[model samples]
Target: MTLDEDDRQRRLPAGRKAQLAAYVAETGQVTVSALAERFGVSIDTIRRDLDQLSADGVLVRTYGGAVSQSTLSRVDRAVDVRLKMEEREKEKIAVLAASLVEDGSIVMINGGTTTLAVARNLRNHRDLTVVTNSLLVPPALSPSAVRDVYVFGGAVRTLTLATIGPVSFRASGGSELDISCDLALIGVGAVSTAAGYTTSNLAEAAMMREMISRAARVAILADSSKFGRRLFAQVSELGGADYLVTDSTPPPDLLEALAENEVELITPDTREGAPEADQDPQ
Candidate 1:
């Protein structure tokens, strides 16, 4: 260590850990090596600090370092990272979902990687109007593919690339043409019978609730991984959704609750890709 750094560490041992926690709070996330370099401490000491902070629920540890506990509780992940996961399942779900809408329908899609996949699948429909809050969706829908595309304007969430805040809500407010959607295709971070449906952002949840209220029918597009998990923000109850489209069946209890709520469950048809049972080996 530099002589200046060593002297500073010696003078403020307790203060250093406090400052480390403060740094993590300010930056949202940090790496062990970066923390070590900043504090002029050994990497092992930084690791110990992170561990203690995590144990106290002050922060949550990642593979390299730590992030604020609140960030972890929200279950937020970057859109790029999420897009790469459950690729095949999302594609199949999107295709099946696209089939449900008529050519001339007006559809609303909420912001999520899976819903973005759904937006992409609708490109072939020439007579549809696609309304969305996702910044990523507009570029994906060419004018020739859909007759009209409407996007809600608001503050953009950098991580998810979706528009949120009060402005977006106002744009879609009231029972008017803006919010008069035939169907809504929504995606969520987690779902449970007890917690209902939840996403990572509160603003997004608020927008989703309004979208659900305005739409004639609401369909939740979720992968099997989202089932049984509950995140920080509740978007709606089990009864809010009219349909659930997924790759596989959820837990029996949740399924029972969904059925009781009259939510239609749609799963991929297994026969589409299965080889014939009696097929001979080459």
Candidate 2:
């Protein structure tokens, strides 16, 4: 079993409840009986735990069990840990997002596993100028002969492996602050129609605000699972971004919200003979 599975199977009652929340976050929803069986607890006990979690707004109570809440709790994972979670989806998202970049254009990428995948895919575009605060991103584009990679300076966040703090604003001054990038790629921790875009880390959120203001256009790169969730820190509202590139078709409500906010939803075609850069949802 994976470590998370193991954690779910053999945790103490209190720890088990916490694990349950994470599981719901991963799967979106779960039934009471399934949660009880997985956690080796009585149905009554599971119900009580769910009630507590729901009251705390960590989950939403349903008929038989619960689903994840729209807002994510203040939980974080390491960069290496997240890099292992959505490898295939991230890569596909990277390919489609990279196609948005043209030659001889400046691009700003924030720090996140999904954005890191974007950097990797853009390595062949030697003529693109890349600016980022992610330590992991600069090296990814090092091999490209036509690329110019700039790593912003600040206090490095060990967990995310990105730089943040007051120094980040200083390092990205002058021309860098002129909102000159052709594209700004961001990663969303939680996003919804009501809550808009959010991240778990406040420092990262602050830095992302600056990146958004200085970019010519903003595009959010997130997987389907990240939808309908809100994190502790608000990056911007729905209208903050110009595009959302993803692998899945968002729900109808979210699609309407995006349209109302004037944000284009970009879903790559998973079929044969589709143009790569701007294919509609399949």
Candidate 3:
């Protein structure tokens, strides 16, 4: 029997409420500004929502934000949250980035939402040696029959849930990588023609910088939202990367800026029948 449309609209499932509770508890803090922006709701609506969430003990209200009261799992807090945000753009970038990997290659992948999508697409490739500091990548690639996943060890940053420290940097640097996959797929919080790639944390920037230096080829995976944006710390110059994979067709001015720095720009085709540029020549 079909339920009344208004009744269905007014009712939310218990599981969804629980999931929202869990999300608030894991994120550490959620500000009204962030909520309003993320959900496209008014600040007053977000405040009221936070008030209800706070009363449930999932979050504690602060002056302008709410703090999580429970510990968050790395997978739940970082990987899942990221996948839900900017999902379509990341998926397009991921499919494009994965097309770069061939069989029997050793590739380094940096930690981020976009890179995680790349890892998911790499599962079918045979005899791949995947090295990554992201806690999320291993599980996604683990079940693949042809790939070997290596999880780098270091202090895990709670925000990104990726390992970073002197140890991780040194280990990544010490490896002698093959030219076949001397390619590193990296992620950044923001990218600007002026500031290059930036991250919210300094240690993450250092780790990414090390990866960039060690790899023979560097490809950056970022969405259009990252364009012209700046974060807290600069990781590398825009010229440092060999290729930039993005979902949007960049503006002419921005395209000229990237081309001037010799950065090759690639955008993926959304339609099934559309042709992709061949990476390897026949």
Q: Estimate each model's TM-score.
A: 0.67, 0.67, 0.66
lDDT over C-alpha atoms for residue 31 of model 1? 93
- Candidate 1 clash figure, as a count: 0
lDDT score for residue 84 of model 2:
49
Give the alpha carbon lDDT tens digit for every residue of 78-112 in model 3: 45445545678887888788777778877888888
lDDT of 2 at 240: 93
Alpha carbon RMSD to native, model 3: 10.9
Of the candidates numbered 2 and 3, which has the greater lDDT value?
Answer: 2
lDDT of 2: 0.79
The per-prediction tally of clashing pairs is 0, 3, 0
Candidate 3: lDDT of 14? 44
